[model samples]
Target: MGRNEFTVAFAGNPNVGKSTVFNNLTGLNQHTGNWSGKTVSNAFGCMSYKNITYTLVDLPGTYSLLSGSKEEAVARDYLCFQSPDMVVAVVDATCIERNLNLVLQILEITSRVIVCVNLLDEAQKKSISVDLKELSRRLGVPVVGSSARSGRGMSELKEMIYNMTVNERKTYVDKIIYSPEIEEEAEKIFEKIRQKCKSDRIARFLSLRLLENDEEFNKSLEKSIGISVEAGVHKKEYKDMIAEEIIKTAERIFLSAVSFKNSEYNKRDRKIDRILTSKSTGIPIMLLLFGVIFWITIVGANYPSQWLSSLFESVNQFVRDTLTNIGTDNMLVSVICDGILKTTFWVISVMLPPMAIFFPLFTILEDFGYLPRIAFNLDKYFKRSGTHGKQALTMCMGFGCNACGVTGCRIIDSPKERLIAIITNALVPCNGRFPSLITLISIFFSASLVFPFNSILSALLLLSVIVLSVFATLGLSKLLSSTVLKSERSSFTLELPPYRAPQIGRVIVHSVKDRIIFVLWRAVAVAVPAGLIIWLLANIYIGDSSLLNYFTSSIDGFARIFGLDGVILAAFILGFPANEIVMPIMIMAYTSNSSLMEYDSLTQLHALFTTNGWTVVTAICVLIFFLFHFPCSTTCITIYKETKSIKWTMLAFILPTILGLTACFLISNISRLIFMLAG
Candidate 1:
């Protein structure tokens, strides 16, 4: 029987809404599960078109097919080995040339290529005209325009796939030949490889790759074949020579084919890139963007958060009154009402809104081609730290959550650099810590303002914190590179894609579904148990006070030395499951003191803290401590899972804790000393 089911793979650069297209095509039937032999994820789904089922696989998004990184290797291997019947190379239409390189490279690998010009709506808005027929003719493939967000041209894309799979007509598009000297060497290597390998496609591809001296690809082949390439005919030496030839050849070809002239299509992108990556302008722009996003997150989240908190508080009061009327035990009612449901409600109200706003907007910037420029902007610093410049991208992901950031470190090529990137990912402030920062900002900094400026101030303070965090990361990375994980720096080759407008509909869906809900669920899951524990500690009496009171009072003096209370300290300890629960836990501790189900307003919140000796020092210390706290549970688990050693995992946890504690201690003590001197 002929191949009845054809496999179609979606390949693209990161943040071009590749996943959006995947979702649109497969819908709810898609399943993402583990691969057979690796810990890396695999996604598979089916779509039937014209009475034939096409199994669509979403390969990991990667910038290039150079096999320098694990993700690239994964993508490269599937295209070469799995030999999918049809390859849907999704190119972000707004950034055609850089995107075109991937399209061109894949064309070299397999002729059954479908060039998907995705984000057409965005491209059109940017006034970028991609002549699909012209591009198709030049590249020798069928090019289809698609707006994955709106489900445009999907039917056509699938039809194209079906036709390609059925016809089995391979289009040998093009291979850009190099200078005579380099091409001669490449040809010699190609002839030798052709004589050894059965598959001409594999032979040609491997010859080019081998000549280019891609160590990762060579290692991967060695592992698969049970023979060291180096042991046979000094393959390493031979491959190195070939690699130089290939690089020179490719360099010539790349220079000949692409131009960086300031065309209208790329004018906005080049202008933005110049400023954002400029030595002088880049840092300030990063700060401004950071400040703006936080400001919006803080102000926009406030009304919704307050309403959600009040609504939850009202339910808590109703439950208590109903239980009293119904003659249920007061303790049992308190446990059920304040402990489980109340905590869940607070988590939802406070954490959800900011994430909902932040993720989509963050994703929008990423989709608009701003993110790669960030990496390019910071590449020099990261390279100096003996890591890939794109580690900056991983650090940005850390702002959402450390676990995701650590996972993103896979983008870096060097093992030493990847580890360094992973170890320091948690230093950045995540969405989980945003509420506490907002609370401090609103209470201390923005209490005097009205309307727009109030939110603006709050946003500015948060942005300052982020900027400070970047400096902290840079310093820590520098120290780490010099001391422990020393290795040669792996420089980055960043392709700045053209800027385009983001799709609101798709951004909203991803932010709501993937980020906001996912994170909220994780928080609620952890918060319920934590709430019950906090309730038990606060309610169960021990020697004239509740367990919580006894503990807090015991540590009250020690906490005072650090300008914090035992309850706040305890909350930090308990909140390791997820940072989102820290503020709610602190609130629970505060409200339980009066056993009140409701508070009046922001003034009441301030009054509660002031009554408990909450000085400015206390708030500052809390802010700093939260900013530099240990990795969350998910991050810890990821560290353990990734390193597979309790030692490295513990190191990942401990080093940060020690640093955080020392920094907070030094800052607090220094402030106190300054005050004493002034007095």
Candidate 2:
């Protein structure tokens, strides 16, 4: 309520550069994606124009106010109830016709609306032209042409926003007159809503929505208006009729205000899509691309990781010497330099380089509009497996972080399929587990090769493990569909956005700040406490053995059944808080060191493993369990938060554990049987 502050809401269809425009206006670094569901919640940023303060709200990207998913519901609810001072409806200049559908719906709810036609540069490149004045005249609303990525038209947009919000002005929108029968029904509903609400704008919009037979919005209407309105057969017919009328109106407006030169602006994108999404080539290409990314991460990160380890070692030694020179207690010195510093640096060294390489490459793909095609290519398998196609997108998100993947399931309109996506998300190893998997593959299988070839082999092997995990996800989804979360397979539409060259500078900034640093911080948060607990276990004695020895010895017999020793199993249990610490914990137990330690190289790590009785069988079991074990604590908590059911969360935990243990036990027993026969 400050004199100069005004709140402006930005609503738009997905991938229309809505967030980009918001960022340009506010000077904030919000990461923009070339896909849907990136803005699952509203983001607010304050921007100044002359003497006026504008607080911009970036709502979730939704096709319409008739909400279908959780994201759309958020957008619709805020705009409907919160009633911002003015609304900016950002549209894609390249596809203004399609984007206009959302604009028309937004205009119906409020009179203070400005249509921001973003991505004008792309439209111009395509030889498509939008007559902004004609469009504004047609919609009876002020329109601003903008290419948000290039910072074009932002000044005009801000100036218009200032004029609209700071100064009182007249505004109007061309009415979307529906069919006679639908209008009559809406009129009756409006009469009821009009009596309780102060504004006729909401009453009119609510009437149309009530006539649309949207039961959820109707429930909200009942509470707001103090009257329940149930839909009948005629109301259902009106729903269909109203949607048809809106489409007709949008087409009429688009034709009047927009023109195309060649009418084939998307030919290049189509040609590329053919190769990338064609059933025969798509899967193979996807595998190859991801394999190459893994290879680069592996080869690129090795030296940096070793250098960081050595550097940290030097720092630790210096710190220890300084403490001793100052006459600090030996135990304190061990705790500071050996226990905490040791584990923390190991995590950072091992995690940072690969993440720094991987996150940016992944961001490049996402920016180039390639990730959705991966979902498009895999949609058929998901449908055949009796799950929603949108699950494929959530599965891709799991590759980054299972917790994020779980949160992303909201995009799936069907609750049954969303839960299926959540429960199986962990099978796909996240950023946290990538370090462990890549390391294990390098040591046990690929390390036999020399130099660069070893990294290539590791990439190939990592690809195979990922392929297996995907299959596990599909199989588990099918099982759950048939039994626990049984439901008819739901259909979903995936929008493949236009390909745009990623802004390299933005990619670097976003990848480093959002993905790499965020994940590394989480790792450090868990590693520090874990290092302390680990040191205590190794140092405290129980009778003739340390607590660590007793802990591992108790699990040795059971672990043997899985071709792993007690030390490995204990490490996994202790690593529950974060997967990044598993290797460090195992190393501490193996050396029987009071503090965590890092091997200088894979060769040294392999030598230590051999000393502790590791074999090919043990490595195989470790890899399997590592891929399929219960998710880390963060992901587990996310699952519970999303599902809000203890039963579902427990199943998510137990299902993966059972599958991993079963696979390990079978491999262990079969190998033992073959060895006995050979003997």
Candidate 3:
């Protein structure tokens, strides 16, 4: 520890403004890693104020430190064992009563603490107010009021932290007192703990944890103290008594420190929820909102995509001319122009615009706090599928990117449920797949409609595909739960946060920085090498035809069985790296163009596909396959990383591919039979 350095940990419940405060204080100086010997993520950052450096650890959000889940265990263990210089408890001002429970638990572990009452603006909006002085007086710690989103009171927060860490301020610690009977029993256990643990705060904490019979925490405490406290009698009864006492004490403290002009702080949110989460309108409204977003993404991307494509084309031509003028080798120019530049251009031009629009809109919903309601609405369905209700939340994440969805499965407490979420996540189409699906729908289905209705029809078609994908997720989840990854549905508490107006600028910055660019970069990394190999296969000759032609001919029979041609099948195989590149590969294969070509409009693309023997049935089969096929390379790698088992990874890959092939074959043959009978 340097003289000017200190460590502080930020702990709080979920949906509080803990993350916002961390980001505001530390800005971009942060990185994340898993806790030692655990899968839970730990975030750390550094900030310098008043010539003193502060290293902040953002602990995972949990309601309590009772060790019921990995998140709670990680948060509790770090605070108890690591012994940071100070602990900052970030609580929601509007719901301060519920948040104070975690704060009281932290007070039992550390004397050095600060209470940050965040979301002051939200509290004010609801006509609820917190007396900061009264809160600090009752808790015997410094209390700061802040609206982190608006950057209010940040300076005071930093100053208070500095004062406490530099030993310039003497603050008292007020520990909560349990009921008479529970306290007497806790004192008995504390005496035994004090023999091995020297710190008074930690000894009491261990005593309580032992009484609670927290298996995970007990193991940790036993290892630390070099003794087993599991011999305590009536442990379960003691835990229940202590828990009831703590809740009563929390209620008493909340009454003293907070006041409300209106008792119903969530009146507005409740009113909105009636319509958004109603049995009748909930699902339909969700579908309509998503449909509108997809409609905007599909219709809005056209002009910008065209502009970008044209710009890239002009740059490609200039590069080609320059290479010729400089006497560069023709082969090298072809590789640079056709293999690398064209492929990269095709991906960015087509993928970027839709993502740019879609991510911001998605962020708006997240910031508005509608996503939890989505999980709330879908929880019963997930429960019926024999998976945890939290899986519904992870499934929604798949819409942005399946890799993220796989990563988001960490929230589920059960190992079995988490694995099920990871495996079935790919059934939901990611943003990468959306471009291909949208383009195909526009070219094949929407273009046949009248002018204003075409875009609406395209959006409806995309929504149907999405609905089908959700059903696939549910069906596969059920099958996996019964057969391979059998588990009972685990329960979890989902907090429906109060809605707030989204900050447009921050939403854009966060979405673009966190999601759009991150996913795009991953796709680009895989697409580059895949592009080179694809170009070589198309350009290299074998017996008076290109190698691609030879391979497509060999696979034509099997491909036809799925209502697809060899060229389309080969394109999908080569497009495993990135779904966004599938249409480009298909175009390159069909036109026999040496480079990836860009069509000016869907009309031109439709004409090309028709010339290549595409019909409505072929398009329908392609859509079904797209919805059900194997996960992309990025998603597969994420699954392996999360599961750490090759067996599960291979199963994840095979399961979806089998479903896709079976569905496409059945649909194709049944349609052909009907046509034959009609003729």
Candidate 4:
């Protein structure tokens, strides 16, 4: 380490509050990027304490050092190779037993370590107490109790880190001693590694890995050492013995160092899980939660959306008046106000509120630790459909945005399973699609009912559509897995984290900053150009009719085959940039109004649609098509980026369009047949 600087790596299991500690320590001075040649994200931050700069590296959270997954590989490789000055193993105090396994693994690599037991408040709430002094003695390292949420023990943690790194304080290293047989085998491998390697620390860790017969580690070692260490004929037997011994040692340390006062420390979590994960009630509860969120969003968003629309409308009118007064060309003014300004307003006004409400609500569920249980409940279904269990998690991410969901498929280790996840991700309705789905449900399905119940019905109706989407995702996943992406099911370990009280302020900040604003910005970027193009098509004349009418008329006959008119079809095509603008585009095409015109209320919008020949059957077909249509342009681009193949991206685009057309055609024909019989 340099005199003025030190590098400290933070490592821990997922959900151990590792991120909270990193953020608290580093504040805003951080940047994230992928590890070299890996898709796993690694973050680094720097902070100054007492004139010394402490550079903090946040490793990907993993349960163990053994490289069973990408996260474990990145974290294990960094620790073994990068050789940071100090390793801070952040453990969940509430479940120190399970966390200690990782700490034990880290200790095997380096002696300069600190065990930070986080979430102490949650532990205390459960009547679980840890004797920090005892734990420090057992682990032969510094152990600090912290509640990163409350900023507790942060100063002490930093001071201890400073002392250990700057002062070169000698610390006791309490190492795990394997059984005599395993130790002898490790010693032999250790000697071989030491003869070939310059670093004594790395040699010791490599011996244990070699004993385990870890092929990946062996290949990595060969690359670094420029030599191969061939195992003896009995290496497999020795590896099994060594692995069993490590497990026993971890169990022994956990038994000695941790204790619970309640004996039923996890009773509350178990009780909640019983209800949330019950076979009969689980799916219904999940659906009900979805409906409640949609209801809250639908009811809560109305006033804000209307106010934002009015505000934007006022701005547009002001811009128009200013342009006219300045003698600006009417065509230029129309392009700016009617085309660009109005479309941007419609997207923002429609998208912002629902996103603002939904993201925060979703974040709350996440913070409360319910999302993994959702994945857990859905895992079996995914497995039965010939996909990996983790697809449930990626699918849930798709609800926020398909592009993000596609990126998240890296968690699945199998390439085939990951591809299945990426291809089917768009089947779920993203936040961009929510406004369109919700508005149509309100205007067409729930408009006739009275106040309170009307909103409830709208929410239920939207939930049904969402359920349909989920089924589509599962069905397609099954079909694709069985055919194009045929593969055996892969298993995954899911940790059902203990539920914690969500931090409202943090949840709000994260959801708004990370999700709502991020997605809204993307939508706006696409909406502007789409609006300008729509305006040009409407204004630019061709022959006796405008270009917009000529194209709509040409497509109308084919569109009616799917129970949609040419105008609606044209709107969907133009609205490919962002799904939120699809309805507005349809409105613009149908009313022959200025591209920027805002409907004051749903009643007026309903009247306009009816005047254009919309009916119950038409609304039903439109809803079905909207639920299953092709992904927006952003998602298509994301698919291409993630897959790095035009073939898969095009297939992803075509699959959903085929499903949507087929569904609409069947529904339209069935409805027409029933009408003919009745007449």
Candidate 5:
């Protein structure tokens, strides 16, 4: 490393604007890469000032280092092991009392810390103020107050960072004093570990850890010291005393350094929470919000989707004509234009517009802190289903991508509950599946209605599907808890963060970069190959029929039992690579095309479906199956990667597919029975 280069570790409790501060400092120069030998990823960013380069590492948001959660362990290990030149403790000034817990804990490990009081604007809105000088004096570290969203106080924060790392100011960190008995016990082990640790604070921290009987910490201690050290068991009272004292110290410091102008400032938020979290209004309001989001997405995406479709088709024809004019083989022209371009653009046009509309709306809700209320509202259902309420958060993630939802299941502390969440996540339709669901709903369910009403009706139907998916998840979670994954329903505390106004510009930019582009690129990657495969299957003929037809005809009879013909089911099987290509595959097979084809609008798509004998029963069955079917290829692979067992992965695939098949069978047979009776 260069003399001017420094590594700074940024740490904080979740939702404290730590990432915002990092983003302000780093801008687009950031990378989310895993540290050596760690599962949880930490974000890294590089920035420069006055010819000196700083490497900022953003740690996972965790409340306490003592908490043995995998995520907290990563943060703790990095601060203890890596020995970064400086640490920045980002805290929410609006809730300084809660945030000080992590900051004080960091002080115990290292005194070289800058306590950044972020979200000062939010605090000011609430009529709260922090005495930064008093806080700095008490903590014996440099403290910077920053309102990162508006770039307020950011310059001071950067200058403080430069000063702390380069100038190396001396800090006398105030330690959390425990009871006499705990101190005496810690002293016995402190000298034993002190020589190796070389810092009094760290030695005392490790010494206290030895007394606490933390197995994870003990293992880590063994690694650092290169030998196992045994400790006598401490009484429960002593351990409790240490934890109690830490909080008491934080409270004392907060009381001395922070003040509120209006004590009832939060009264307004509490009143709003009453309705948002009320049992009766919560679910209804939640449904309405999602319904409106869907309505907007369905209505707003129309013009842009059509426009992109026309633009891509024009580009396709131009490319095709240019190739033909150059005497390029007709086969080559068809492969490039009709096969690859058609399916790829079909996915892009269909998938991009809805995502562009959906993710930003979702992100706004996320930034406004309403998402936790979603968990609060749905906690009872998940609790009844034998899982923690946090499953709701993961299920919400599934709406964007099931693969992401599966990865997010790590938040569930219980192994059994995490598995259940991962297995059931795909029940909720993701963005890739939304296009097919909306198209089918628009064509069959709401086509006869007028303009805005039709969009609203489609949204209601879509919301109904979402409701059913949630219930299905609950029911499946219950079944798994009762069956192979038997476990008691564990209760967890869901924190309802105070609501704040979202930063709209940051929300738009982050939603586009993080969600829209990532998903669109994935869809395109899978679509091109899917398009080529469709072409080969359609063009390769055996006897009088093409291979695609022969295969569909073979499965046609079996498919009839579920109210869907062969082409639809085959499309699903082929679309395993990505859900976005399913409709395109179906269109190609239905038309008996030698390559992929595009339907200009939902009207044209509806006509095509009708020509292929798609009845209401077919549409309903497809929609149900669409919701229940095996997850897209990405999600299944994520399931396997997480579970690390073929058995669990196979079960994940089978459970949803079985549900889809059973639901389709019941619906198709019941519809037929009613029709026969009426006739």
Candidate 6:
């Protein structure tokens, strides 16, 4: 421990609120980086406690320090090589025994540790009794129970860290001993590491990793020590057999040291799982949950959508009339009023309302811990598809943006599974597509002449499409794994976290900050340029017809087969930068006024579509095309980066295009034939 200043590292198992605790301790002062070229994100921050500054590094969350993956290797290397002044090993109090495995591993490396048993509030809520002092005595570490989210026990935790760092207090950790054969191998590796690295405090840890044949840690050590310890060990030839024995021995030691007892809550988990994960009930419940969320979003979004639409339309009318009353050229007036301003108006009006309602609701469910249960329920399907269970997490992220989904795939350990996840991520609908889907459903599928159920129908249909994509992804992944991208399914463990009461304030702010504002800004930015371009094409006459008219006529035949026109197709293409701009572009083209924004009702929208010769076939085709179509701009960039191959990126683009066009063509043909027969 250092006297006045100390380096404190926070380590924990995944999803134990370690990041939240770190953020609370350091506020917003944090720096992020990749640890030794691995994709896992790491962060370091500084916090002052009792007149002493502690530099705290937050390690990647993992189940154990076994170095089974790149992230585990990063955490293991930092703790071993850096040798922080004190290590705060945070464990979830509710799941103490499982989390203790990691703590035990950390203790083997350094005696300078304080076990922070967090989530005490959650534990108490579940009526689980934890004797903190007894646990502290048993583990031989200073135990502090905390709920970091509510700021409880944080001051005490800080005091404990400061005291340990400055030698004002001391703690011991229980020693774990393996069987004679395992102990002998560990001792042999420890001897080698001590001689090579000249540090006994960390040698045992290094020895165990070596025995496991951890590729990540071994590579890390090679960079640190300028030699491959594995190569040297194998150069002896007999060491390979010795290394195999070490892994077998370590696994026995690990299982012996950890005891998983079933509590009353565990029974409840079983009872809940019987229904939640049941073949008959799980799918229906999932469908119902999705439908309900969409219904809420649709109902809540309508008034705001109407308000925003009216507000934008009023501005558009005023600008157009005032400019026309002046001596300004109609072209100039149209460009200013319709092209630039109208596009901005429609983007804000159409996009903002739905996102404003939907994001918070989604966030609330996430915060309440429902999504994980959803994932847990679907894990079997994914496993059968030859991917890890946690690929479901990336799929959830896809709802926000597919690029983000692709980025989140780093959580999956297997290279082949992660690639498969990335390839199929675009199948999930992102927030940008929400407005277009909502508008289309409302306009085309009204059950009542007076009231619209479009948003409701749209949400359900979108959910169905998402479910269908899941199956499609699983089928493709299985095919790929068996044939071209053949690889074994990487073993994955998922934490089905206990459900909790969600914080409304946090949910709202997070939703607004992370989703609504970010997407709205993107929509407006893309909308302005798209608006101007649409206006130019609509107004610029080629001989007798406008440029937009010419384009529409040129693609008319092909569009008919696909149940779309050149104008709608072009709008969708332009909207690739941001899907929120599609409806605005469509309206602009249809009205021939760069700024017509008064489509406040689905009836008005339907009238507009009807006047333009839209059919049921067109609506069905549009829906199908939107479902299977091209990746957005951000997704394209992500594809390029992830594959680092232009070929895969082209495949991502072309595969969707072919599927979307074929699907739309088939749907249009069947729909037109049915209509003709019925008539």
Top candidate (lDDT): 2
Q: Model 2 Cα displacement at 376 (Å)?
A: 1.5
Backbone clashes in candidate 1 total 4
lDDT of 5 by residue, 425-468 (tens): 99999988988898899889999999989999999998999999
Give the lDDT of residue 277 in candidate 2. Answer: 86
Off by over 4 Å in 5: 29-40, 194-200, 219-229, 513-516, 542-544, 593-598
* Least accurate 10 contiguous residues by lDDT in model 1: 30-39
Ranking by TM-score: 2, 5, 3, 4, 1, 6
Any residue pairs clashing in model 4, and if so which? none
When 2 and 4 are scored with TM-score, the better candidate is: 2
Cα error, candidate 2, residue 596 (Å): 6.6
lDDT tens digits by residue: candidate 3, 1-679: 4369999999987777687788889995221111111123568889899899999988887778874676777788889888889999989898888888888889889878999999899999999978999899888899999998888988999999998999647778766677676677778888876867658988887777776776666687777656585544445677777777667777887999889999887888998999999999999999999999888888888888889888988998999999989999998888778777777787877777887888788768777777788878998888778887777777767887898789778777888878888998988888778778888898889888886699899989898998888888889988999899887656667777778778879777776666556556855686677668777888898768999888888898999999988988888788888787787777777767433445656787887888888888889888888878889998999999988999999999999889989998998999999999998
Compared with the true structure, the alpha-carbon lDDT of candidate 1 equals 0.72
Clashes of each: 4, 0, 0, 0, 0, 3
Please give the lDDT score at residue 194 for candidate 3. 81
lDDT of 5 at 355: 86
Model 6 alpha-carbon miss at residue 408, Å: 2.0
Report lDDT per candidate.
Answer: 0.72, 0.85, 0.81, 0.81, 0.83, 0.72
Error of 2 at 524 (Å): 3.5
For candidate 2, write residues 1-679 as lDDT tens digits: 5469888999999889898999899987776777787766789899988878788999988888785677887888788778889899999988888888898888888979989999888888889999999999988889999988878999999888988887755686767888787777778777766877647887788778877767777677666556466632244577777787787889999999999998789999999999998868988999999999999999988988889889988998899999999999998888787678888888888888888888888878888888888878888888877787778778777888889889888778888988999999999988888988888889899888888889999999999999999899999999999899989767688888888878878787777777666666865688889988898898788787989999999999998988889999999999998888898889888887433435868888898898789998899999999999999988999999999999999999999999999999999999999999999
Candidate 5, pairs of clashing residues = none
RMSD of each: 5.1, 2.3, 3.6, 4.0, 3.2, 5.4
Candidate 2 segments exceeding 4 Å error? 26-28, 48-54, 222-227, 230-234, 593-598
Error of 5 at 41 (Å): 3.6
Residues 1-679, candidate 6, lDDT per residue (tens digit)?
4467788999988767787678778874221111111124468888997789889888888876663564676788788877888899887777776677687778878888888878888787776666677667766778888987787888888989977877657776645655565557767777766776635757766675565565666778888865365533322333444434444543443344323343466676567667777889987987887788887777777898788778877888898888888878988987988688877877777777777777777767776666777767878888787777677777777777788777667767777887777777776777777777777776676434343455566667767666776776677667666766679767776777765667788657756665556766775678778878888988899798888878777877777778787777877776787666777777777887334545667788788877788876787677667766778888989988877878767766766677778888888878778889999
For model 3, the run of ten residues with the poorest summed lDDT: 29-38
